[model samples]
Target: MRSNIYIGSKRRLSIIALGLIIFLFTTGIAHAQTVDGNKYQLTLAEAIRFAKSQNKLVQVATLEESAAKEDRKDAYNAALPAITANGSYQRFSQLTLFTDGLSHSTTGPRKPSANGAALGIDALFNIYSGGKQRALQDEQQSRVHLARLNTLDQSGSIALQTAHQYLELVRLNDLQKLILDQLNRAQTRLNNINSLYKNQKVTKSDVLRAEVVLSNVQLSLQENENDLTITNRKLDVLLNIPDSVRIAPVDSAGMPKPAIDSLLPFIESAGVTAYSVQKIKENIELQKARVKGVESSNKPSIGFYTAYGLNYPNYLFFPPVNQAYAIGFVGLKAQYSISSLYHNKSKVAAAKLRERELEVQQQANNDNVRTEASSYYIKYTEALTRIAVNERSVEQAQVNYRIVNTKYLNQLSLLTDLLDADNLYQESRFNMIRAQTNALNIYYNILYISGNL
Candidate 1:
């Protein structure tokens, strides 16, 4: 009875130890999962927003826009009156006159005033410049618009690039999962072959083949891991994040998939709304304004000018005077560049030529955008079709693999048949994933071309 009681206590202790180990293992796994979940996760929209704000190209474009705004301000300031102040002081030395040569007088020397001081203010208001100032203002305004359009273009380009890399990473992750699953199956197959070989049911060659296949799957997994790391780093650069941090996309399923009811709207929108097209249109306006400015040089410029000042030892009088005197004058000023009459013709012609060139460029850009939009629309539709086809292929390949695997296990088929079916199965799955990602990518491309992204 004592021996039975001791055995019961020992069994109870063993049960408690087992329970403790299980609890600790589960807790550790949960903790690891929590840590993984805490890692930085980003959605596509968040990434695009971050990139637009932080990307070097976008920042450069924004700076250019700011500079253009400053230029506009300068142009406006040119139309305002210009005022200037001046002040000066000087000590005069004694002056001697040669009275003996002209007057034949014995007076030795005469001194002018001891010192002189002057304070003055001048103002010039441009009342007319043959419309040159107004034209320049218009040109600067167009430049501001162009710069802003360039910034928008840069932002859109970066967003598209970010989406590409982000989707590539997501695709790689999905492929990794598939490859890992295949690796396990390969390992199981190798083990099964080894077991059969030990029973003398399979040849040594069969075992070697299974090992090679398993090795190949492992190699694929390694290659995929390398690609994942590289893609993650690229995305980090785009996001302006630290290279050491790895980013995982939160979800790609939320990407827009607009219906393809009509392609005409996209094409039309791209021709008018795309940043490139808008920039060209602004450039044409800028060139026209420049032409007007060049032509204005041939005409006269008229302005109002005024000056007022106080002077000591005033030199305006014939004899030197010691007392301070106030002086003031106001008049209208006109200027005409005789050389510009001949020289400005060539400049105006050149400016007009540039304007025409921009108009031609605008036409070309419109055509290109329309073509691009139409092409992407077709590709987007094609990708949807391919997705359906690949889905069916995956189903067929999965069924074929199961049949071949069962046949090999029952010793009714060669190992090569099983391996081929397995490879086909993996390829089909890979194709399916590629098709899905390609569809999403094409959708984004369409949006980008249409300036809607």
Candidate 2:
């Protein structure tokens, strides 16, 4: 009876232990999630969105665009009339008295006090500025357009970077899994060889060789894990997420099939209008506008001005003294500056030179875009061919590994042959991964360089 009670107690203790372990494991997972801030199932679209929102480069570019808009607005407002108000007050220590020399008597000053105040409003309307205002408006418009394009360019660049990093993280994750699988196979083989050596069916050297292979596989696994960690960190930084958070990508989709037929057409269409190319072209226009503005500066400007003022102790003869009165004036005017004329020739020459330089740069940039697109296309095709070839190689390697593995089991093949075949199979798989990833990267690069991304 006592023995039965002890057995029941033992069973209850085991059950309690299992429950504790379960509780600890569940809580551990929760703690990991909590420490990492939040778990995000990041997708390509989501990554791009996050980068656009959080990237400092994109933010700065947006601000520049806004500033350019304000500049354009100011330029537009320059064509409107300007109005200003003025006021002044003065207090004298003593009043001035006019004396009659013949009578030797001083007539009392008309004003009761030595203090005075005046207020005025002045208005000016620019009738003409020799087209300088129009030129300025055009230049400002070009700047605004350039700023907008630059913002788009910045966004495209950030998106491309995010895609590259995300793809690399995915590739590293796949590679780590592959290496872990290899390590597992090596460990299983090592165990088999150890048993065979103990039974005297295999030599001690065989066991040592197997152990060495297992250690190498383990080292490879460790290196791959480290690589995964670093790649994850890079992606986290790009997404502006916490580094401690572990990302498990659920999108295991491999490289997409390329639409070869449309790729060249898309590149050609997007190449001409690329933001970089367009910005340079617009800069040329801006410089031309500056030349016009410089020429306009040497010409004359016509305007109209009007002013009305009220003053205490009116000094006008028509207005009675010792009283506040109003004075008004209106006039048309024309003015020319010889200072700008002195430098106009040089300024125009400099502006033309800058415009020409920009044209040359624009042409060069267009050529570069074409070249980059062509090169990326070639790389993508090569990757496709490599994928096909490596896929065949993997098939062949798999068959060879199976045959060698069977032969080794039957003692009809050397362990070296089996190990070599296994290594070949693993290498072929890695090659396939490389081919696929390279193809994906190059295709996206083509899109990026074309400014279509």
Candidate 3:
């Protein structure tokens, strides 16, 4: 019974000790998270959503898009028939009218002769107008298409900026961590160096060098912390939030990028080419341009009209007089300006120039986009290589630092060796961090170009 009680007590003690360790580790982690820093953790999707809804550039793009939509709607509605209703009432004072040939020998003043009210409804169905309306409609549609494309472009630009800034913030944070770790190692080395100097085993110069290195690292850390603050403020501004509110970089770990071939094809095909996204813009303009050509060449537009009216002798909306007069008439209206004054020629020339300009702009955009795609692809590859190389470097530096520290303590290596290894490890770790961010940024940039943003 006594042995069993001892075993139970030991087990209970082990459990209590394990609980304390878990509690302490959890508390430390929580405390570290609360440490003074500007990073407010945000995921990529979350940041994108915030920017889309709140970013200033995005707001402008959205407003312009809405206006373009309204213009397009108005243009389309112009294609339908139009109707108007009009009403009028009029009374004439007593007068002798000479046009009626009643002015001769009129001894007494003529009484008021005509008073009437009339209501009419008229509608115009554009039978034909040299394709003018169609051309106008098409032009408006093209403008809308251009506006939409511009909106996409704006979004892409802003997304790329936001994504790049996010990555930079992450790199800054990693560098801060790397510097802190190096400072700790430097402090440890300083302690050892002081001990050896006290025993006359090491020179004072070694201690001073270590202190300088430590101080420099401390300064770098402080600068990086400041940069982190700046990044957070800028990000908040991009999100249109209060600058005091902090935002951290999104984690870029394990993000999948689109295939380069697929992305390249998309960039290549996005201009005046067939199956291009910008084809809508081009086609709408082309349609408008052709109709304008026809309209200008036709030179004459004719409209036919007829109307009938009945009038009573009273000026009330409800005619009071019983007597009524009825009249009906029909007529044809036409317009043709005899012109060799280069107006038609100029219209045609301008239309052709505009079409060519749209084509040229699209071509230039194609080239620009293709060049950007290739550059970003190359950048992604380089960043990935850098991350790999830097990861190995960090590991090697860690091993070197550990070995040299042990040797220095045992008096087998110099203090300079230990410091060098320590500095190398810290720099390599920060480089790795920066490379990780660069890789992620390039991936997001590619997505923006590909219209995935």
Candidate 4:
């Protein structure tokens, strides 16, 4: 919300305005932006780094992290002794010790010259007040720790989402290419059929079907290209970059090849890691609650302070005289409000209940995290297998299309048969690419589960 905009640039404070208008208007932008001029160049590592540093959500996490660090420092400082200093100066027309007109000598009011100043200092070292200070310090520390852990949790979430978006963009790019390829093939077939019909070797229906197929493919390609433009804009906003910037996807050769053998180990490790980290954080809170309970039971407090001034008189008795006295007194003191009997039965009970609640929550979290980690691991391996099988299927489909087209040219296949085979081939290839992209994403998903991404 706070930024220095170039002259005449509207304040882009909300997604509704930009997303509905300028950001979505990707008329001049190309799909798949590249950092360098290398061909086929989007990489997982690059995406991860870019998202971590540049994503709008990631920036918010960074700010929370910075604030947490400051809070931790303040909590740590609370353990030290507290010191305070105060000073004041004032003047009055008269300082009355005793006045001349009392009840006639039964009382006396001494006249005093009017000026005074006070300077005082105090230092209260926590000798020990039933552990209240320590408890408060612990609570502060726990809150700080929670801020950091939560940031990491959010980081993992953001990374997973970005990876998904990036993978889908890649899919859209590949699908667009496939659509173009299909369009070209349809046009070539249409030309062949028309030539054959001119020689009285093909039916009019064959020419008509080929032209229709080409028209359909062309229309689909147009829509796909538009969708790709929109996808690129979404990615640009995430990267905090200009949406109109050009972009292009890398080839399959750059996708990650995960270590399949470690899949189970990674899952197990993620489960255990989550449990341990959560226990460490939760225990801190419980310990703080217990410390507070003890301090309240001890029922102790204090309040005492002293202030003094240098003695000086600027006026003389009756005849007017000037005098300054060099005198000062320093003293130390303290007071206590100790309970005569135990009075906090409810607080102790609440602390015990709170600790029990954390224990229950810890157990619940372990169950949930284990389930998710295992599921993610199994999904990774399954996706890998799917991609391999789908790739082979697509290769075979390509061969089928080539053979069918050649047969049709030789008058051995029907026009409908040829069109259907081409459609199947394109669809198969797209499926393969999608499976591969998803597999690559699932493999990296292990890091997200372990909170290491």
Candidate 5:
């Protein structure tokens, strides 16, 4: 019975020990996760979103659009009546009638006092401006549309820039990984050489050569690390994140499928929808409206004005009286600028010339878009082809490295040959990574050029 009791105590102790180990292991893993959280892992879409939210260029475009909206509102309010108020006080030397012998106050006229004051409010509404008001309103609305299109253009620019930065960061990160792997292989090679030298199978020179190769790999590693750091900082600036924060992109899903051959439809459609093209079209409309406004300036403008007034020392009477009176009047007034008829002919001609210039400019923009779209599409296709070729090169390089490494391990090949093969292997991998990044960048470039970004 004592033996059974001792065994039971041992079993309980074992269970407690197992539980403690599990708890410690879980705590360590949790700590590691907490550390990783310090770095922000950004995806391509998220980076674009962040840039849109915080980029100064995007913000500036948005503000410009808002200002344009205010201008449009002002144009709308111009159609409403305008009300004004005025008050004046004057101390004249004397009040005299213009009639003959009005200075003979003792015989017939009584002179008024020197003081005069008046307060009045007037409201005027332009009943017609010969289409000037309508044309101005249309012009402002077109400007508002142009401003919106400009905002879209800025947004596309910022998104494309962010995407490029992110892709570069990914490329650098992968490059660092490749360098680290190469360094490990170099170290392993050095150890093997050292063992062979100790056994007298290889010369001291071989060991020294291996050491030099490892050092070179280490230097390369350091260079890649430096590049990674700079890339991270640049991406942080683009994201508007704190410079101290590190950002890393998770493994991307790779490049999107290319429809380069069918890109003609997209390119052709872009001319009508692209911001630059649309802005030019709006400009043409705005200039035409300006011509109408200038033409209207030559026609008669009729306005109705009404005012209520209080005047001290009324001057309406024959002799005048020292008293205050309330008065009101309303009337229609029409006036034409005879000089506008002569001057506006030239002005209208200039405006029409400007409109025609914009039309020509718009045609140029359309042609540019077509050329740019086709060029980017071709570039994207070329990048895709390069990726495929690099993939095959990487495979061949891996095989060559393995054969050279095996021969060196068997003391049948020189260390220099092995190092050369390893360098080629590393270079192949780097090239492949660069090709992939280039392909992704070109893909986005196509989208940007097509105005689909």
Candidate 6:
């Protein structure tokens, strides 16, 4: 009786452990599902924001902007007085002097010290550098401005790219559902055809035709799934997300279409406020500054210089002194490079040419921006038109599909007619989705080209 009681306790314990394991497993799965569900949900604006922050191109542009800032600082520092301190120690093995006379004689210090040390601080402030200093400073400032513009440009580019991929993913997601529905329909039709064949109502050829349609649809679905995988991975890289995470674009159904009454505003904005245009303007300024810098080389430079020092053996005196002595001096210095007058002519011309080249480039960029903006606007309008047309087509195709299906069921239509109607319905739906996504993409493109995205 005691043994039976122990066995019963053991069995109860075993059952309890089993139940605990099952509970933990179920809880873990539920938690994982919740986390994964939250992780993959993303909106278009959120995706663009994430890409701007995490894209490698945007990050690199930001780093370049930082470097340009440092360059500006260095240029500013160049305008300030340079101060430096230096110290030196030397040991002399021997000290000798020669006296110039009819009978040449060599002399030595009475009590020469073997070691000598010196310390000094010197400062030089530029009073004038023929405007070179100002020109260089201006050039560096222009560089900083250009870098900032470049960062903005890169951020915009990344945003647009992210939007494209995100929209494509959304399109694929929608298509996936539509294709699945088509697959189910195809499967049902095939099953019905088989049933009809068994009952001698339809021939074996009907079953084979249905099978082919199903196979083609299955292939299409597989291709779309592959495209989804690739697009998701690309978006993950842009957002710096883990590959294991899958993104699900928020449904854009019933989202209001972007509206614009005219393309003139976009084209105008692209010419004035576009990052490309701004960068070129800054580059032209930079080239002008460089020309000034080169021309300044033909002029003279002037500065104030001062130095103070303490030396162990005062070499300033004719006779060597054992005690250390302090020495200081201040003076104005000026210099001219005679060769620069001739040598810099070519350099100045080259700089001016470069400035002109930038001006030409600026004009070209303006033209390109206008053209690109107008192109996108036109495309956007075209997509809107397509959307309307495809909507009507989908409605008509759906009606036709229903009619043909009913006729086939009533033995009043051939299987081919039903299959064709089904194909038209699926194609119309696909086209409608494409038109919607394409319109969204082109709308964003317009914003991107105008630098307003």
Cα lDDT of model 2 by residue, 163-273, tens digit: 787777777778888888888888888888788777887788888898899999888888888887887777776655556545655444364658666678757755686
lDDT of 5 by residue, 44-121 (tens): 766676677667888889999999999999999999999999999977654344545664443322347667899999
Task: Give TM-scores for every candidate, taking all chains together and pairing residue i with residue i.
Answer: 0.88, 0.85, 0.76, 0.78, 0.84, 0.87
Top lDDT hit = 6
Return the clash pairs for model 1, or none.
Answer: none
What is the TM-score (0 to 1) of candidate 6? Answer: 0.87
Displacement of residue 273 (Cα, Å) in model 1 is 1.0
The number of the candidate with the highest TM-score is 1
lDDT of 1 at 53: 73
- lDDT comparing candidate 1 with the true structure: 0.83
Which regions of candidate 2 fall more than 4 Å away from where they truly are?
A: 1-37, 95-113, 318-320
lDDT of 3: 0.67
Model 1 misses residue 441 by how many Å? 1.1
- Candidates in descending lDDT order: 6, 1, 5, 2, 3, 4
- Model 6 C-alpha RMSD to native: 9.7
Q: Identify the superior model by lDDT, candidate 1 or candidate 5.
A: 1
Report the C-alpha lDDT of model 6 over 116-208, residue by residue, as the tens digit: 899999999999999999999999999999998888888999899999999899989999999999999999989888888898998888889
Tens digits of per-residue lDDT, candidate 4, 1-453, equal 234464224444233334323432343333334354222234545555556656778778778878877876786687576667676676755323435766334433233535555555556555545666667667766766666676676667777776776777888888887888888788888889999999998989888878888889888988888887887777667656666544555545226667778677767777566634554555758566565846554556543333344434544255433455433333444444555244556667667777777777677777777888888778887888887888888889999999999998999998888888998899888878878887777766777776667
CA lDDT of every candidate? 0.83, 0.78, 0.67, 0.67, 0.80, 0.84
Question: Candidate 1 — which residues are off by over 4 angstroms?
Answer: 1-38, 98-111, 252-256, 262-264
| Residue-by-residue lDDT tens digits, candidate 3, 380-433 | 878878877987898898998889889988899987787778767777776777
Name the TM-score of candidate 3.
Answer: 0.76
Clashes per candidate (backbone, < 3 Å): 0, 0, 0, 12, 0, 0
